[model samples]
Target: MDLNHSINFSSSSSTSSPFDDFIPLDSFMLPDCDPHLSTKEEEDDEAKRSSFTQLQKENIDLFWNQQLFEIQNTPVRKTHHEFPIARVKRIMKSDGKVKLISSETPILFSKACELFIMELTLRSWLHTEESKRRTLQHCDIYRAIRNDQLLDFLVSIANLF
Candidate 1:
């Protein structure tokens, strides 16, 4: 595990990352960005970033639009969930408070978990765009979970990422 092979840090007194790999330290400046200048596009982006609710609403609208397209084009689709019912049942049964669950209950839970994963991935992608990165990072997902109060339940899990 050679440090030079993975990450290369500059020796300059002023912390300026050349973007060899990774976000490198705390610097959030996008590539080729001039700190002193605020262009029209940058100002427009700043305005968009200021309102989280509007962004969330837009995302939800896009999701529903896609869903409607799917519904219209494919009238008959099988009920499918990415989550395995067996795994969901095992998790549901893990809690001592739960004694027994009906057959349909596990299926519903599996579908719910699948929907949650899709929504979380969508939200995380938004964060990735905010960082101006083509690739998704753990921090992006962490920021997504942190920003949404409804996702507070996953805060502990996100911290590990």
Candidate 2:
């Protein structure tokens, strides 16, 4: 089969030339945007950002106030074995040389432990509020742990539990 015979050489009957069908690229191009127009959009974006930040701060403050209210309204009670006195004695004993713990030592340690727990809970709750969350979560505690370099060891130890 001849390759020349396979191809059609017939001319089109249409009157429109190739240049007539062609569209100018500039016509399809985007119009020049005003620099001032973007500045207006930027101002709008800045306003939205500031408003969002203010909203978050307000939420945090509200959460903190609610927590403070709850703390004030709640009655403080002293419960027996609330702080694991025996565990404290064991820990003191585990120091190798000190095999015996005085009876009064456990009682004082228990009170100290209670205070420590309350303080840590308050701090962790504040961290939660800072994140604009009303409810406290474990991640808040983790964040607290991470924020304090002294608690880095506790973070690894607490993960086991």
Candidate 3:
């Protein structure tokens, strides 16, 4: 009933104190500082990244190698057939006899053969099953020449020069 009686500040044997502030048993000190990420988690993450990069490099290399292999293994058609006309004319100056004089632009027999083969293959592909026989045009032959088209054009220039 008394104000002084209710506000009891002195701790006696009978009354328990409820104000208990938390205090850590050990003093708070930062754990040893690692200059680099030295934890197991960091190491695992770095290892995973390295492995992923290595795998990606290997896959890229394999893909490129396979592409190169396919390119190298592709079959190139040869020219030697009769369907498309392939000719190499060479004119050598002569006094009805032996001495070799100035000669015209000499087309190699091997190159002529290659041209024939490519031309024939293209003509064959273009020909239908019913009508196979047809006179292959020189223009068509030139058009069908795939790889050496530029070379042939250059040679024509060289002959002019």
Highest-TM-score candidate: 1
Q: Which stretches of candidate 1 lie over 4 Å from their true place?
A: 1-48, 51-53, 64-80
Q: Could you arrange the candidates by TM-score from highest to lowest?
A: 1, 2, 3
Q: How many pairs of residues in model 2 come into backbone collision?
A: 0
TM-score pick, better of 1 and 2: 1
On lDDT, the leading prediction is: 1
lDDT for each residue of candidate 2 in 24-61, tens digit (9 for 90 to 100): 67844967777676878988989976775575456556
TM-scores for all candidates: the values are 0.59, 0.44, 0.27
Model 2: lowest-lDDT 10 consecutive positions? 1-10
**lDDT ranking of the models:** 1, 2, 3
Q: lDDT for model 2, on a 0 to 1 scale?
A: 0.69
Please give, for residues 75-119, the per-residue lDDT of candidate 1 as tens digits: 442366577778889999999999999988987677567667778
> After superposition, which runs of candidate 3 have C-alpha atoms over 4 Å from their true positions?
1-29, 32-38, 75-161
Task: Tell me the deviation in Å of residue 128 in model 3.
Answer: 48
TM-score of 1: 0.59
